[model samples]
Target: MTAAEAARQVAKHPIQARNPIQVLGRSALSAVRMVGGVGVFAVRGTIAALSPPWFFNQLLRQFVAIGFFSLPVVGLTAIFTGAALALNIYTGGGRFNAEQVMPQIVALGITRELGPVLAALMLAGRVSAAIAAEIGAMRATEQIDAMRTLSTDPFRYLVGPRLLAGVLMLPLLTVVADTIGVSGGWLVATRVLDFSSAVYIRNTVDFLQGWDILSGLIKAAVFGFIVALMGCYHGYNAKGGARGVGRATTHAVVSSAILIFASDYLLTTFFTHAAK
Candidate 1:
């Protein structure tokens, strides 16, 4: 090949090789920006929540919506999860002739991990989507803008209440979930696994510590904040039209789920070290 042609071929290959790198870099940068945006949104909402002229009624409404209405779903999920966990642990333990320990394992697993994680995951799917869709619709319809024009701070009126409610209610919901989950495990152990109910309950209570339950609640609070923050952040930034709102809702749920898992790991690690 001619020198110029060879040089051109070499340059073309470099450009082609660099294209994927550029795309990846852009993706990383976008992720960073998205995370930063959510962080800023959370900070703003927190500040608004703590400021004067608080909206107690709005906060109360959100508390009921997020906590009270969410009970059925959370409770059902927790119970089912607990029963399944007990069955699995019993089966696994039977293989090693350790079936009697299933009660303690079930209790520990539920309180230290599954209760907060599963409850948060369920809430992320239900609550995050709802918040995102509502706020996205408001943004699409320019109602948020209208509120600003009427001297209403959208952050305080909209985002703050949701954030506060999530932080407060998720722990409560998780506690209910933990109780249901433990009870379900006990029921399954007693009925299906032929375990003594009194023995199971006694073992569970004996094996579980206050810190184990407290750690789960703490994790729930963080997950709750993540869910609400993701919902509000995506909804607030939604653009385009109906399509944009739909995208925001999808993003909110997906992001909240991911953050829940990620934060769960971090919190679990922290708690483990703290226990040490």
Candidate 2:
């Protein structure tokens, strides 16, 4: 028997038979119900987004809060990542006396992969948790019900703005990250590693293909969408009290991170093939 079966048997009522079949059937039904509920919500959200009557103010707030507030953290990560990438490349390439490739490699890696991926993960943790907690708390306090009672559509006010914020802010944040990352590599190559700054920058420019940068930015937008969607989805559905809110927060981060990595691979494939 599975561990779940054994646990069920142990918790079985004294007068009832320990029926694993019933347990399995109930569990299967629960799974199906959950899947159906998710489909409903996804459809509902999509339809709502397509509707012409929208909440512009809330959308603007989401953009400013998520994109503007996220700048400092994203910038810091990119700068450090760029510097460290340069050092690592210099060390590895020096084995073949090819340390000159640091600038181009760092630039490519940061813009095409690390910048968007890392920024999304970071924002996932920060933004997702905050959204889940705030929404969950409001839910626990019955504010959602209050909105419904007032004839307000919660999805348009809450989910739409957040979704728009993520889509918009992510690309902007990526630009900042990309620029900062290249500058970081410049610093390391010129001052710390004693390479000529002009040579590094020029080579980086010459080696860069448009697709490399474009692919990463596209991934950022997708990642941002996933992160915000998961956050709002989990938050809107959050159950119970404080404990449920915590669980929703955890699920948002975990789900968003997985989707980001998965989307990155697909985006990479598209860019690679297009370039060919």
Candidate 3:
């Protein structure tokens, strides 16, 4: 309304406009630092894994913990996912009088994407939280520091075996998921959707390819690493006491799940481009 007041208001508007940009810049910088931390952790863990005094027993134990114990949850998730996918696809297809394509669609959806991604998400919730809580407790109790004092390499003795187990075993879990998922689709198709089992199976087999399954396995491996890495990183760095351990567990699961989805999108994009 007045000359001086208008000038001051105009200047204030510019400063306010810069606030959001400044906040965004700081956010991006933090994200870069977090990524750098994870990358460094990966490098250290990888080196410890290869240069190991070979913790074969620890690795075997991790395999049982991560892979074997995970079967039931993964299988159930896959079966329900596949059945739901089939039903949804069949319903959508029927609107176009193409319900017969449900089998092929279900197979492709599961093997190429959903099977690995969903299984990884489930494992992230279970395994990541478990790893973080266990290691966080060790940190709180000073056991990890004690190991270091005794000339034991914590990276090798603790992180390496779990990391290696996750990288190796997730693919196996994905394979089981894929198999069960396809079977579930078959079941829904025949019993619930009123389709011939043989025809559905044949369609699924015909549409499937080596690359479809291979890509899903590869995604599973990456997701597995993400899960283990986040868990160990949060757990290893956690401070304070019980509250700190709780925070680390929550962070591990949240970060792993977010990274899984982000990496899934990138991998899917790359694979789609490569296929083309």
Candidate 4:
């Protein structure tokens, strides 16, 4: 082939080949950029939360929305999860003739893993989506712009309260979830599994350590922050009017759920090593 033709053929071949290495490199860069953007957003949010002109009214309203309104769903999820856990544990332990260990295992599992994770997942679905939808709608409608025109910082007025409330309230909700979950396990153990109520309670109480509960609370706090952060980030950056708001709502929930699980694994690993 002539030099010009050979050059054009080489260019076409590269385009057609679709190099795996190049594809992977592009994906990795995109992921890094996304993570960096999220980090910057988180820093700005934290600064806004700490600055003056605190809005206690907004914070109180968020408390009711994130903590109180979330109670029924969180509680229901915890109870059913605990019941299923108990039944499963009983069945598995029965194979080894160790069914008596159900109470202790149930308590440990709930407090250390299930309680905070389940509660946070529920909040991500309910509270995170709500926050994103609200803020995204405000963005789509230009209400955020109007607030800025009125000399109001949207971060301070909008993002700060939800962040504070989520960080503070989720641990409390997780506490309630832990209680309800343990109670459910107890109910199943005593009623369905035919375990003695008093002995089961005693085993659970005796086996559950302070660190187990504390670790779960710590996880809850982190998950809470993640939920709020994801919601605010998506909502604040949303565009495309109504469609943008809808997309933000969905992203908030999905990202919060994914981050919750990811962070839970990290925290669990940290706690495990620390205990060791």
- Candidate 1 lDDT, tens digit per residue, 1-276? 975574455445655535665556555666787778877888999998778778999999999989999999999999999999999999999899999999899999999899999989889999999999999999999999999999999999999999989999999999999999999999898888788888998899999999889999999999999888888888989999899999999999999998898888888888778778
lDDT of 2 by residue, 1-276 (tens): 996785465446423534777666556765687668766766676566657568888877788789988989999999999999999999999999989888989989998999999889889989987887778887888999999888888877787778778877898899899999989989988999998877988999999988778888888988888888888888889999999999989988998898899999988888788878
lDDT of 4 by residue, 95-145 (tens): 999899999999999999999999999999999999999999999999999
Looking at model 4, which ten-residue stretch has the lowest summed lDDT? 3-12
Order the numbered candidates by lDDT, best leading.
4, 3, 1, 2
Tens digits of per-residue lDDT for model 3, 1-276? 875564455455645535665456555665787889989999999898788497899899999999999999999999999999999998899899989889989999999899999889988998999999999999999999999999989999889998998888889999999999999988888998889878988888998999999999999999999998899999998899999999999999999999999999999999999999
Off by over 4 Å in 1: 1-18
* RMSD in order of candidates: 5.8, 4.4, 7.0, 5.2
CA lDDT scores, all candidates in order: 0.90, 0.84, 0.90, 0.91
Each prediction's TM-score versus the true structure: 0.92, 0.87, 0.90, 0.91
RMSD of 3: 7.0
Name the best candidate (by TM-score): 1
Clashing pairs in 4: none
Measured on C-alpha atoms, candidate 3 has an lDDT of 0.90
